[model samples]
Target: MLAHSFMSDEKKQNSPRPLILAVEDHDDNLVLMSYALESLGCRFICQKDSTNTVLVAKEYQPDLILLDILLPTISGIDVVRYLQQDALTCNIPVVAVTALASREDKERILKAGFNAYLSKPYMIEELETVIRRLLCGKIDSTSGFELCKE
Candidate 1:
């Protein structure tokens, strides 16, 4: 085996690398999510605190948001609602990526106004697909942008 093997550089890859917002309190979860996003080769903004999601979202202007239901100071539901109400950030998609695994709970979250709802411990492919669709504006309906060509 060669001692000095040159690894393929990640930055050189052509993935769009959107500014995805990952709002999760768990450090491990955040890291895990980062790993998944990294595989897709996308950059991200993380908000470990629930209270600061809007502020961070506004500042970062992420393409999509992955919110956890159980958060401090504020709930993910409120954050989703807030984003939906804001004109500047309203067009962005807010997807619930939580551990709350109940059809009733999902329905409730959907009713509260989320662009999409996904469960925690989800497959990386699912997360990627979901985020891709949302960010690409495939969901449409008062949202912004279309699927990126490049």
Candidate 2:
């Protein structure tokens, strides 16, 4: 199921608010994430799993993606790989939001293709900071997208 955060067409057209694609399966986590994204003034689309992640990313072209490494069918590492290989969604930043907090796990996830990593139980401020940094000049300008490309 894809749940979209409500944003009026007029507001979306006139404002520079970033659109996010959040791929997380846990219901509690999704609720918390939804609140945080909305509080940070972002419009987001939520996917419960990685089943249609690539397709959604291509169609929505979100400014950022918050992905859970442990998903139902496919892992988030594999999902990021797919996104990187696609021209349409390649430059979009993807962040790993997972419980794997070990140093080796972080290194492996980043190596796999995620632009950023946020361990589970992250503060809302951390989420805000990551979103701001990634979305800044990301939509129109290509300044911060070099990380995504690599």
Candidate 3:
């Protein structure tokens, strides 16, 4: 299986693309994230196995990480803890993207050190906003997208 997942677009070459590390176990979810990143003119590295996440993050040092909370072997929270402890990968921003939509779940996720929390079945615009906000520190209001509330 390919460890990295992305779709190339020549039009995005005018400028450097932001590198994103996506940790998702499901193929469909990876595809969806790939589409989103492609549309945003960004490059991404994907890992289906959570156990290798910290290793990959340290190696690639992506600008941002989209992580799923639940995984087959190790939970995303554990992965985050590993990343946080590693000086090489500690500075990268991590966003929780999962099905955990309850208010308490969101709070717990934020408390666990995720820079942002985005629930599953999210809108494309919402995904873009969060990515831009965390990576760029601000959203482009000209995109006419509003913040999504959970």
Candidate 4:
């Protein structure tokens, strides 16, 4: 199977893609989430947990961040707070890609300063729409995002 790989390992060696910092803990969820992102024509750097989230964000300087609520070292709330507080990284928009997407969860994360939230088991179009809206400033709200129109 390895020898018959479609791309021929050689081509796979130099795929140049922009990096996005994805902070997720659960392995299965991470795979699913990544699949959706890739399906939407997005590329990223995956961080297993919150421990290296900051360092990676700083170093990698990804186009956007996808964070989980629960992490190993620090909480996702704290991660948002930290990014919002620091002037250098303050402009970066963070989205809560987590299972905690209840009303309170949404309210708290927004209050804590996340640009958006995408509940688990989400669709590719949803991620694409949210990211496009955020990047283009089409959705006008206090968080700099407009609510989805009905």
Clashing pairs in 2: none
Taking all chains together, each candidate's TM-score versus the true structure is: 0.77, 0.82, 0.82, 0.73
Where does model 4 exceed 4 Å of error? 1-18, 137-150
Candidate 3 residues lying further than 4 Å off, grouped into runs, are 1-15, 137-150
Q: How many residue pairs clash in each candidate?
A: 0, 0, 0, 4
List lDDT for all candidates, in order: 0.72, 0.81, 0.80, 0.66
lDDT of 1 by residue, 58-149 (tens): 76677778888888668999988888888878888888989998999999998988888889888766877787687664332321221232
Q: In model 2, which regions exceed 4 Å deviation?
A: 1-15, 137-150
lDDT of 2 by residue, 114-148 (tens): 88999999987688778778887534333233333
**In candidate 2, residue 9 scores what lDDT?**
37
Q: Give the per-residue lDDT digits (tens) of candidate 4, residues 1-150.
A: 011101112221333433346778787866765665554444666666576667667765666788888876789999988887776678888988877868998898888989999888787568767776765642222321222322
Using TM-score as the yardstick, the better of models 1 and 3 is: 3
Give the candidate number with the greatest lDDT. Answer: 2
lDDT of 3 at 109: 91
Q: lDDT order of candidates, best first?
A: 2, 3, 1, 4
Query: On residues 67-126, what C-alpha lDDT tens digit does candidate 3 reach at each position?
Result: 999888789888888899999998999999999999999999999999999999898788
